[model samples]
Target: MGLAVGAGAAGLAIGGGAGIAGGVALGRARERRTADAVASGDGIHQPGITTPVQDHLHFAAFDMMARTTRDDVASLLQDWTYAANRMMQGLEVSATGAVGGSPEAPPDDTGEALGLPASNLTITFGFGPSLFDERFGLAAQRPAGLERLPAFLGDDLDPERSDGDLCIQACADDPQVAVHAIRNLSRIAFGRARIRWSQLGFGRTSKTTSDQATPRNLFGFKDGTANILADDAAALDENVWVSASEGPAWLAGGSYLVARRIAMLIETWDRVRLSEQDRIVGRDKARGAPLSGGDEFTAPDFAATDGSGTPRIDARSHVRLAHPDQNGGIRILRRGYNFVDGNTDLGRLNAGLFFLSFQRSPDRYITVQRALATDAMAEYIRHVGSGLWAVPPAPAAGQSIGAGLLGA
Candidate 1:
């Protein structure tokens, strides 16, 4: 019953009494527009990777059942791909959506998102390191860099929320749309796979297009002020999508995704003095400019000095340490979100950033995170849960996702 006609790139919709089953193609075309459409003529890359971050996210990880066979995984992907493609276009999981299904049977699509526009929904799939073992006979096809992420400083990762055999990231302007996506997908995988962990997030903390303003994190600083824009194809090639030469041919044009659930000690940070806060983030409190005296977009002057000859930008400051200039020009495309899962039992707010980034290789993320081992802001955040997945190229029409690896 969700809006059968998704408003396209223009971002408009006609809801209520329009009939949910017809005019589905008009919804698909308007909802997707060309910006995030399949990039290669063969549709070699997935949509959500660079499709301009949406306002809400419902990310879930899954593991295949113990007795599930290779065919099970293949069939799951085929069904999931078809459903995902349809849902992204503002259609239901199937033609017999919600109210259309037989009265005796459960609705094919959840009714929660009924009457909602597509809201620019996008579903991206990924394969985790654990899925590369003999279970599926995929060890030989595994990319060389695919492995569990090594430990880092200030980590208190929770096993209950850490790794999974697979992951799906659903993003949309409407919270209901995003959640609806994961719900239906999970329903479809019921017999073969179950959820390992999931996170619901809001208030996107980054942007993929220059037109969108940089968003703030729970810490109240502008995050990703210099994030790579979607128009910068050169930057994406250099830092994001995997290339043919990288081998494991199935992943070319695809990217590696890293998700870190960072728990912020927001109360503690709120108590810190403004000056100290600025130093920790290394940016002006109001404008997000570097301490070295420049606007938000100006290149930070790491070596500039104050009146007393002290370095204007602290070497341990987050801005200084995470800058591409200091890290061999390495950058990851961030599509993070802010999350507050209500309050903890202690009467403190349990909130933080759900950081999501895409890079050409896993090593790229490891290198950057390693460089942040001594970050000044480390005092205010804890890396509580983490995961890394190798995303495969978008499949051609009628083909299931990851057909390259499964030979489906």
Candidate 2:
């Protein structure tokens, strides 16, 4: 994202691209990182996780409408599943589609995405902590570590924008397609669910395959230099997917999602000295290689030193503190984005990193974040909004999205 792993999560592709999954409960994990696969996941886990990071993101959180029944919730999910599948296949949301609908009424498909290919679209659904309450009768099914994200240092979270009963992460190469997916899904929700707070992001800061090069955040530094790949089956199993031994059966093959809206102090950063900036980040801004030396992929040598006997890396540097070596070997998969919501009244750009990470558990993130409390870059950024969602495994063949947790 905009800042660094301090507001970020980690999952570096160990052997090139998305690592291969080993003892996965989800069906056969893809063996190789293809250039592209519109429907990439193997039907066991959702598509967005290991799928190649898309160019745009339309992430939304929803709260079920008041006075709705369990059946209402189930119906909404079924409707969402069917429609999401259709859109991913590059078809209309319904048979009638936008232009073919009745002239006397609104159209089934919004028509905005008509004629556009799938654009490798993926729609991932998740259940927020609030949904574990009695409204849907799903308390016992809540995974053990599923709860509101703990307060972290430098958090400026907005109450109205943080948590929700449900969340949907729609990613695609086309912004229109991504937006259309959320818009149509919201329409399908109708009176059953309404948007809480949503974020629109573009310029992906991570990649999952060898074909895609490392992308950069607004901070002018490359990210995803070592992120999980689309074909790394092993890494997916160990670092991303939740294991059966760690779960309440319903969430076994799924992973937890952490979202943070970080605001970058653009003006302040633009004024910092280049050398000081490199020291704060602990990497060569030009190559993303550690100040400790080596190429971008060279593991950082935290103990390297310079002339005059000064430490090459600052103790509080972002890379030094956030590295897995320093975090009890905990790593999270990051697929974050650099975001800019125009400018503020003071004529400064309201921009930052929209941090997104998928981990085996929420604690994985909490652990890494906790280690970054003293991050030097924390002075240049502030976490504005946050959330945690339990992403259930992909439904069985021919089943709707949440058939497991909802027990439908």
Candidate 3:
């Protein structure tokens, strides 16, 4: 009788575990379907997702607030341009020029020379529930919602995987303003549902010499040759492009994946010439594309040789390693912005990239980046920004706004 009881207990335990696993599998399937529906324009709404109302707020607020409106979107696009531009002036002044791991470590000056600090500094902020649901379009479906999927838990909410409804970002000469802008936005959304938020920056010690900073790795050659290029065009239409045609009608104008990262290491990169730099990076120093290339997506022949008889696709090149073996299998959609700080280490420097990319699966995007991290560029760029989120499906109408799906 005792033996029988033990067998029954084991069966119950196994059944319980299986039940949880089933729930997870179901949730993922639901999430995938929601993305597909929205992409396909199907109009079937998920239970707890948010809507594009927030995106409207972002558009309108910036349209009204900025000094220029003729090209508000254009200006926003411009904000993403250069590394040490006026947009980051505020951050450069207020930033302590400290690395992520050490509070006392000073910013590396060589890093500054290579234009690294011009883009590494960043302060991120997100809206709260109040602003997200009511002020934004995620309001309950009872009277105005479109009805979408339920909110995600840990698995779905992985920062790298999700996107946000609205994003308000700006950089001045000081980091304080960046912090202020983010915090202020959060306040505006506080009374309702809260959005996820965090700040990410850079790290590291100095190699002290330009040779150490040379665009090469310990392997001694230029690197980062085949990185995929990204602008709003690629991100909005090509990559984050989901087909939710089967989703609820209200979710018609939704988008996904607002990824961000803080990549560092500049001093060593400055030692190379502009032309050499272009080859190492696999993009024009100013235009950011292939050296033997056409547009951002145009493929460069790795096997091509340069005038120096060197492999056009340097083995250590960022592009070569990312798309190695002449195989085009790896591709990550990048939507990154640049930042800089000259004030962090008592006005010295700390810089790198504000890495951001989006994809249907974190594994897909992360796998490509992992290759870069281990490639020749690893010594230069270290990942400091990390988070995952479940961009809620567009909101539904006349149900509970962004409730079940968002929190479920």
Highest TM-score against the true fold, candidate: 1
**Which 10-residue span in candidate 3 carries the lowest summed lDDT?**
52-61
**Rank by TM-score (best first):** 1, 2, 3
lDDT of 1 by residue, 1-408 (tens): 111123443332121111111111111122211112222243556767777788999999999999998888887777677667667767776666788866886777777877777898878899999999889899999999999999998999998898899999999989999999999889878789999999999999999988899889988899989888877879999999899999698998789999999999999999999999999999998999999997999899988999899999899999888889888899999999999999989999999999999999998899889999999999999999999999987765446678889976
TM-score of 1: 0.91
Query: What's model 3's lDDT at 383?
Result: 54
Candidate 3 per-residue C-alpha lDDT over 1-408 given as tens digits, one digit per residue, 9 for 90 to 100? 000000111211111111000010011111111110111122232211111000000100111231323233222222221111111222221122223224454331112212222121222222222223433234452212212223321122334322333344333223433344344333323332234444332221111112222132222333333333222344333434334452333222332233444445566566656666655556555544566657544676777777899776567666665673433364444333344545345442455544443343344554555555435555555454444322333222211122223322
For candidate 1, the lDDT comes to 0.81
| C-alpha lDDT of residue 74 in model 1 | 84
Model 2 is weakest, by summed lDDT over 10 consecutive residues, at 1-10
244, model 3: CA deviation in Å? 6.8
Q: Which scores better on TM-score, 1 or 2?
A: 1
Runs in model 2 lying further than 4 Å from the true structure: 1-41
Clashes of each: 2, 17, 108
